[model samples]
Target: MAQDKEFEIVREFEVDATPEEVWTAITEGTGGYLWPMQPPEPRVGGAAAFGSTVTAWDPPHHLTIRSEDVGFPTQSANQLEHTVEPRDGGRAWVRYVHSGIFTDDWDNQYDGASRHTDFYLHTLREYLVHFAPRPVAFATVDGPAASAVPEGLEPAARALGLTAETAVGERVTVRGPHGRPVEAVLDHRDAYFIGLRTDDALVRFFGRGHWGAPLGISVHDFAPDADAKENGAAWQEWLDGAYA
Candidate 1:
């Protein structure tokens, strides 16, 4: 039998929110930033997200959750930990750690996870700074298998009127599913990810084709009447057209 190798990804960053707020954001999820998460119980042995068990818990300070089976043959166990420290001016410093044991295909798995950590943390900062405490309806969809090529993100960028030269803070307008023009600010972009923030929502595109997965899209709509299922279907249809 092959030996299982352990991997860890650690990220440290500063955010504009206080320690309590940052704790809430990481533990409970910020709607537009992360998938809605139920806060774990305040003590060890409580359940956490992703079928994990809480191994450590300290309110507004530290938390650690562990899972025995992560639903992947390549992985045996997974652990996620977060530490928050208060800064001088109501801001907080956060340290996040994701560790796991990989039974196989370690390189690809590690690379993908590390890159995604960057994107997710960036969205967390955005949420803390601009949209904290707002409830949002979330939707996600994936493109067809045909969109799993190296050039897959090209069509999505074009559909959003973006290009290789699109930089952060640039303004652009795109037609929503209902053909309504929506103005958005490009918030983040890189080889495998793109993010746009509008007045009422945060939109993200995942160029997973670069890592052998189909493209993906997610929207966090803060409108009071937002519908996740309906919007997910509409965005899926739009993605179909983009790659058609």
Candidate 2:
């Protein structure tokens, strides 16, 4: 199916945590550390991030939030829905759906949103695994191209400040334009994307255009005691410089 105005992004993920835990994270922590500012309250009629509103709230089973960017009035904004299903051994399966309308130019938006969806879900899993009880600070920054990963991923890894040259289960340190190094490990790296996991955050840096493929960076599970607002601002600044 071609990405069009009616494009709906659907993604599935398996979490090593229980449904109740996942539900609690989504409901109480306002979707669990995905926002730089306050998380949207989960109840219907509650305020949400990006100046959006909550449309649905079903504990541990389903949820939905709707919002729009004033910049594109006709774009219909975004209506995001999440569904959680219980599995054996205290595991859970989660699905995400993003529905929206657009008058024109959806290719880039769809691709970017799709990639972002993946990255955020990965963050969610990380929360369930490491930082479920603690509230968090999350940041995402996007911009123009800097450079592409070389024919191979080593150059890209190096550019990301990764010490390991191989994929999967390797150590990495991604220093954004800010020069502060985020020590992590290579979870996955390819021509299209790079996934790195740290004790406090999960960072996904893009490959094309110097890691500026619209859905740029996704950071989740930073230090719980750290100031969320300040951390978010710092990351945003680093992202801005990295893309510049």
Each prediction's Cα lDDT score?
0.86, 0.66
Query: Tens-digit lDDT track for model 1 on 61-102?
Result: 999999998988889999999999999999899999999899
Clashing pairs in 2: 147-210, 200-221
lDDT of 1 at 85: 94
Cα deviation of 137 in candidate 1 (Å)? 0.5
Q: Model 2: per-residue lDDT, tens digit, 173-233?
A: 5675457676777776656567777887666665445233343555665575655456556
TM-scores for all candidates?
Answer: 0.95, 0.72
Query: Candidate 2's C-alpha lDDT?
Result: 0.66
Q: Listing every candidate in turn, what is its Cα RMSD in Å to the true structure after a full C-alpha superposition?
A: 1.5, 4.7
